[model samples]
Each structure stands twice: as C-alpha cells, then as structure tokens.
Target: MALTVELDIRNPSGLHARPAAVFVKAAAGFGSDIRVANLSTESPEVTAKSIIAVLGLGVQRGHRIRLRAEGADEADAMAALEGLVAAGLEEPLDEAPPAAPVA
Candidate 1:
C-alpha cells in the first residue's frame, strides 16, 4: 500500500532549486516509488525522485503538498520525508532574519 501525507511547507523560499534537490536526493535514497503534488496550487503529482518534476510543482512557503510512496520501503521513505519537512528542509541559512543594528 502507498503511504500518503499532506504537509505544509515551512521553508522560507519553499522548495526552490536547492531544497528541491535535497528533497529529490532523499527520495532517491529509498527503493520505493515516490510522488508529490502541490495541494495549495493544485499542481499535478510527479515523481519525487526527479528534481525537475518536484520543482514543477511550484511549491511555496505555507503551501500544502501531498506526498505518496509505495513499495517495500514506502514507510521508511514517508517517515524520512516527514522528518525533512519538520526540519524545514534542514533550515536554510539564507533565510535567517537580519541582525539589529548596534545602537
């Protein structure tokens, strides 16, 4: 059976090129077949292992994305992906807030 999850994106820039690559990388580590869809934008589901397909979803911050995985390692794949989302895609450093100027 395929494991499906809908999660909100927390990355400040959404799943832009770099983070999308990370996502694809993670998905590729599993033997399961994974796919994703941008629920907020109603984007079509595409193979999660491909950076091009993942980026085509146009996922943005706060957008809801649906992930599905099927195969022997589907459970592990879903758990790994869920962890990544919870970590804000490893928390991109560029999104750090600017420091206050010294008075």
Candidate 2:
C-alpha cells in the first residue's frame, strides 16, 4: 500500500515557482513513485516530481495537499518531505508567484 500524508501548506506564497521547484527536486531524489493532489482545489493527482504539475495544482497558502508514495523508500521519502515542509519549503513569504511556467 502507498504511504500517504496530508499537509496544510503554510507557506505564504504556497506551492509555486521556487517552492514547487524545491518540492520537485526533493521528490525526484527518491526511488518511490510519489503523487500529490491539491485537496482544497480538488485538482487531479499528479506526480510529485514535476514542477509544472505541482504548479498547476494552484496551491496557495493554507491549502492542503495530499502526498502518496509507494516503493522501497516510500517511508524515507515521506519523512524527508515532511521535514521539507516543516522547514518552510524555503522562504515563507519572500517569493513572488510565477505567472506561468518558464518553458
């Protein structure tokens, strides 16, 4: 079964741009398959390793997101991600949200 977690994003700017990038980077380091869904917006679940997908969730401050990971390192991935959120996902409010993904 997949390990799942629901986190209330406390960042003032939410999961956009840099925070999203940081999250994607961290998620990509794991061998597990990780999926994230924005519960508040009812966005479809998407892979945690994609910056664009995470950004598309329209996550904002106080929004709740659910994470699911299933694989050999699912536990570690969740713990590390939990730590990342606890660490404020980098700057809490110093970032400006991106208007669009820079492709």
Candidate 3:
C-alpha cells in the first residue's frame, strides 16, 4: 500500500544543502520507496532518497510538496517525514564561545 501526505516547506533556507541532506537521510532510514513532488512548481516526483533529485525539485519556503511512500513501512515513513517537516528542518546552532573568561 502507498501512503501520501502533503507537507509545507517551512525551513527558513528552504530545502537547500543541509535540509536536503537531512531529508534524504531520513527518507533513507525507511524501507519504503519514498517520492516527493513540488506542488507549487508542478515538478515531477522524484525519489526522496536522492539529494540531487530532491534538490532538483526546486522547493522553496511556503511551498507545499506531496510525499508518497510505498512499502511495508510506508505509514511510519510518512509519519516521521511529516514530523520532520513540521519541525522546520531545524539543525543545531553553533555554540557561542566564553566571553573572554568574564575578565
């Protein structure tokens, strides 16, 4: 069976380098055949596990994309991806250094 879901791109930088990499990594963790299509741009659906293909979709902030997964783990894959998207693809920020040892 196939599971489909529509997700909004809320990442500030869109699906660029890091976010795309993260997305591809997440998609790869599942046994499902995952695909994503840019609804706003009407782009063709591409394998979600490919960073190049995901980047080729040209997805931008506020754009909606359709995620389709087919396999035994389709439901779990969809759920995980949906949560990731809802979280805005946030990565850990760089830590600040000590302020000159508070001299």
TM-scores for every candidate against the unseen true structure: 0.87, 0.87, 0.85
lDDT of 1 at 84: 90
What's the residue-level lDDT of 75 in candidate 1?
94
lDDT of 3 by residue, 1-103 (tens): 7999998787756799898898999999999999999999999899999999999998977789999999999999999999888876665422343246655
Instruction: Kindly report which residue stretches of model 1 are placed more than 4 angstroms away from their true locations once superposed.
Output: 92-103
RMSD of each: 4.2, 6.2, 7.5
| Candidate with better TM-score, 2 vs 3 | 2
lDDT by residue (1-103, candidate 2, tens digit) is 7999999888877887998999999999999999999999998899999998999999998799999999999999999998898777886553455467779
In model 1, the Cα lDDT at residue 16 comes to 93
Q: Across residues 2-53, which tens digit of lDDT does each residue of candidate 1 receive? A: 9999998878788998888888999999999999999999988999999989
How many clashing pairs does model 2 include? 0
Total residue pair clashes for candidate 3: 0
